[model samples]
Target: MTLTFASPDQPAIALHVIDQDARDGWLEAQPPQVQAWVAANGFTGALGQVLLIPGADGAPDRALAGYGTTDRRARVRFPLAAAAEALPEGTYAIASGLPADRAEIEALGWLLTGYAFDRYATQSAAKARLVAPDGVNAARVEIMANAEALIRDLVNTPAADMGPDQLQAAAEALAGEFGAQFEVTRGDALLERNFPMIHAVGRAAEQAPRLIEMTWGTSGPKLTLVGKGVCFDTGGLDLKPAAAMGLMKKDMGGAANVLGLARMIMALDLPLQLRVLIPAVENAVAGNAFRPGDILTSRKGLTVEINNTDAEGRLVLADALALADEGAPDLVISMATLTGAARVAVGADLAPFYTDDDAAAQALSQAAFQAADPVWRMPFHTPYETLIEPGIADLDNAPAGGFAGSITAALFLRRFVENSRYMHFDIYSWQKAKEPGRSKGGLGQGPRALLTALPGMLDL
Candidate 1:
């Protein structure tokens, strides 16, 4: 909740970023005292290396940061994070031989280093601040940083506090803030509303499952966002190992990320009509829990066989996608942490996205690199359609053989979405270790790339 953006044109301490090839020339132009300090410390301009120079009054002068050579292979991702995190709590300016987007990159890292999840703890975060770098829009950078922070906050909260009801409250509050319309279909109402698959997957838990819907923007092309809001996945009738259940709280991370993206779109006032749909549920075990071998009817009127109750996220998402497809929106994107195969295929950092639209796929590929967000476009392989088909039902919720699990799961969701230009992101959402700008907790994976690519795609 800190005001991270500042507008001071000049600052006392500055970070001069240099590459190894340009280090000697930059240092020779410096004052003799600074040259002596640099020699004393053996300051070779390696990536992430930091050097502190001394002033004439024996006080601290401007700092030095090393960005590697101009070669793409030598460059590091989020390189400014090290300098930003190491700096003390004061405003600083940026001086570097970076590309045209240098100002935006440095400002983003400055805000990222200040993030700390101290809700239940007594410790305060490091209060590092920076002046708005030249040529960068401070307001735009803050909008993106705040949205990413919101995603981490919602995903990091324990399931005991973040359940189906809390998820609905978050969406309602977001809609109210922007004057958007909001409604939730709860409990038995889901059955009456023709969302039978959603109701069956969540009826076991004490917290009645529901669908969270929000509508905004009165004009422009329509974009419908559907997120799998499985608040806590207990694996239902088929249980999981204790270690596997440890991070089930993060199953709702897709919902958190979609909400974050929605926040960014509204904050920027993009020229597009946006609607968010989340099927919030808790797949817990009870006496009346839906069992395996149960063939349930979906909102799309297709019957799905429950091969394993553990595969409940897709069931809830199927109904939501059906409702979104009914409107034939310009774009439909569904995000979920639904498969272990995705993590196995691309690891935790790189998420896999499936899309049948070639132009959107190309745009997302380009945006991922420019935005510094890692996402790979996996094929919506038509050949894998046989894997999702069971003998008895129109589709199988949990297909066996474990071959191409992620592809088969995507194919299963495609059955519910018939007409829209669809994209599905199978994300991990939780970071097991700390990276340059990301911490060892919940992280937003694919939203930044979409934010960068959407305006151009919609011709806004």
Candidate 2:
């Protein structure tokens, strides 16, 4: 449902800012009865205390929310969002003059507080809804939230139901909804089309490997999004530990996120030619699974020696990215839950993106703030190019030493996109714990930031 700003006839709810150090001044400025009442009952501005002060006529005056010295950024977003949930069912504005950052933060908190990921659940009573401020974009906020929810739902589903065929179906459904052209290249046809790496990585599975492609819009800069759609990773012949395999169902999170972002782009009708490519595969272990030390030819004509079969995301992404780069799109971006080193560096909350274009990096950083989706820029150190060099083949899909795993993965994908200005995002698309907007489940990374910035990035 849409949210709006205050109406002309409606009464504006006052938000009185309270702090620990500035409580005395606020108390002194209050009326005699209110001051006496507050003094009688010890009231310090300790985070989230709500107190209603009565007038001399015995009526409620305003709502007082305590935010202990708003100098530091709170660890939990709960405090900033308390007003949205705690306040009475009515429109409220920030009555006090807050810092620009905090003001924007408060606005975001209000939007996040309204997020409900109950796609399959039955709707009941309406929860709290707030009006946007003077210049805030309510539609954009809701779009981002809805897109994230879509990604979460797709990733949360089990691998049994969300395999390669389901991945292609999801892409086809999105295409049908947006009236975008859709196609899939499956089975041995993958090999015929020079996607040998994709076939090699996924041929072991009962379901065939397929490339999911969708295109929309006709007259603007070409913006291509390539996502790694490893439906489930059994780690091929290499195999993963039982503990690590627990959350492997979320391996296709990158694909889900791309579709989520595409939903926003299509919904907004952004003036750009959008192309989405997802290489759908399931790295299941079987008798015919690709093994280590095997040489595989990629769509880009690069010979890659497989040092580890577990690093399969890049193999599927290589073919999709090659197809995207063939059109020489102005901007081609790819996202994948590709490496463990990225998780070690930034943890699960942040996605580390690699790009050689300075303008793209700046645009992404700005977009992250605009969309309330946080992403950090990681270096694409060109000197590390030699790390993936193989003695037998042109390149090694998995290097001997696993030093800079995330960086090497980005470099490997770079070999696929020769002409397009490309960027790669290494995301841990699962939240270990619950938070304000992000619940404890499969999380979407990089899409919000990418979706918000695409207009300016492509000069649309």
- Please name the candidate that would achieve the greatest TM-score relative to the true structure: 1
Q: Which stretches of candidate 1 lie over 4 Å from their true place?
A: 9-11, 68-76
Question: How well does candidate 1 match the true structure in TM-score terms?
Answer: 0.96
Model 1's number of clashes is 0
Overall lDDT per candidate, in order of appearance: 0.86, 0.80
Which clashing pairs does model 1 show? none
lDDT of 2 by residue, 52-129 (tens): 666657755666666666553256544556545555565565566344555554565565555454555753322444
lDDT of 1 by residue, 166-275 (tens): 99998898899888899999999999999998899899988999999999998999999999999999899999888989999999999999999999999999989999
Worst lDDT 10-window in candidate 1: 68-77
**RMSD, every candidate, angstroms:** 1.7, 3.4
Pick the lDDT winner. 1
